[model samples]
Target: MEDSHSSTVYKCHLLNGEHVYLKIPYSNVKFHRELEAYELLKGRVSIPELLDYWSGDEECPGAFLLSELKGQSLTREVSPTVAYHVGVIHASMHAIQPPSSKRLNGIQNEFSNWSAFIEKQFYSFAEDVKEVLEEGLFNQSVEKFKKMNQQLPSPDGPSFVHMDFRPANIIIDGNKVSGIIDFESVRFGSTEVDFTKLYRDFLSADTTLYQAYKEGYNSIRPLIDLDVVLSFYRFIDAFNSIGWCKRRGIEKNTVFLEENTVRLKEFLR
Candidate 1:
């Protein structure tokens, strides 16, 4: 299973001084995901082109080589116009229908129904997070979701979604998006789930960016209504992050663990 950690990306300069990236992925599953995602999204989106890959054995991490997308990672330092471009790129990703084989490869994203998928995320990850979180917090969160379940909208389409669509995944060259990176979490699922990280990390802090993002997305495609299920999805995102840290290593993720704990508590309230 691919965890929360990304592959190590190494920049290599050719004799001519041009560069490519040598990526040593965290898991074989991630290697498969990057390879498949790069292959499927070629020319469809601004992604690094994959050059070669290795499935790797238990003793060694899976790895890959790919072309580099030269630009800065689109972090908090972004403008509304750039956010709009990111929105367009994201909407395009959601418009795709990944093959069943690729869908099944993402073990966590195999569910066809978004509601069931969210339920399973809570049920399975809840056990892993119980020890890591404060006492009774898990139960409280479960009850909260149970109540919200009654109000959740119908299942969104099983479209391809960038599972980790945050600013860090977006690359900006001037006002436009040069490329997007890290497709290891690509999956076919509800598009609303993709909004959580981007909203929490960037758009939530700036209304102009959020509005422009929506406008850009709507210009390319009609979202059923992100507002309706955003809270539900966002809560799931926070809850899952807590467990992800616990499973990956609490010691190494103190800041992330603390932030997610705060988010989880806020959501419960």
Candidate 2:
């Protein structure tokens, strides 16, 4: 079991020849979010079943166990067939609207206006963005962000979204996606945010896998104005990554951020 940035994962062997993944989260929010999200999406998707969790006392802290999913991560290579299967799974996840009757103690992303939301999200890392950009450049980026937000489509109604849906989180078994792990960033929000990684890699590559993914996702729920949404989110995601790099001291590897900033500047024109 590999260690995630926010948690330590351990493969534990239990009695009756069953193995389970024990995850110890550094933050209570991550632990509870995963627990609640898994509870909400147990049978609905191809995910490792949450077996049990312990909100440990003062001595223990927090821990959870999930039935070990059997598959290899598609980090290196994801065939077109597997990518299509992943798209199908992701579509299913997006299809599951959060039930009004139930409330999980999870992250809520309810925003009244998309413009305000974008501004707030960006300004949350205002200092960090300023750190990497000059005063004029920062103001220019903010102006572009505001203009883009104004043209965004109306709310598409809240839907379940894995904020970090990428190749590393997808598990493959032969030609199909067997498991989708790492639900800590899961939330109910704009469907556009979920397409960030896919658009960045698959869309840019224009590979058969991306075509299969587009076909499969459209087969379930059509991605109306996907290119437009991806365009806006590409900038938003860049701002986020730049902030992350600043926070984590990885400013040297923000080549994508530079490219995204150039695109955002062009979008303003």
Top TM-score: which candidate number? Answer: 1
The C-alpha lDDT values of all candidates are 0.80, 0.74
Off by over 4 Å in 2: 1-3, 11-19, 56-61, 109-115, 251-269
Looking at model 1, report the run of 10 residues with the lowest lDDT sum: 102-111
Candidate 1 lDDT? 0.80
Assess candidate 2 and give its TM-score to the true structure.
Answer: 0.84
Candidate 1 similarity to native, TM-score: 0.90
Clashing pairs in 2: none
TM-score, every prediction: 0.90, 0.84
Off by over 4 Å in 1: 1-4, 99-111
* C-alpha RMSD in Å of predicted model 1 compared with the true structure: 2.9
lDDT of 2 at 161: 82
Q: Model 1, range 1-269, lDDT digits (tens) per residue? A: 12226567778989998989888877777677777787778888889878887778887667888887878777767788988898899888877775656444533454366777678778888888888876799888888878887798766667777789887778899889988888877777778778888889888898998888888888878866878988988888888888888887889888888998999898887
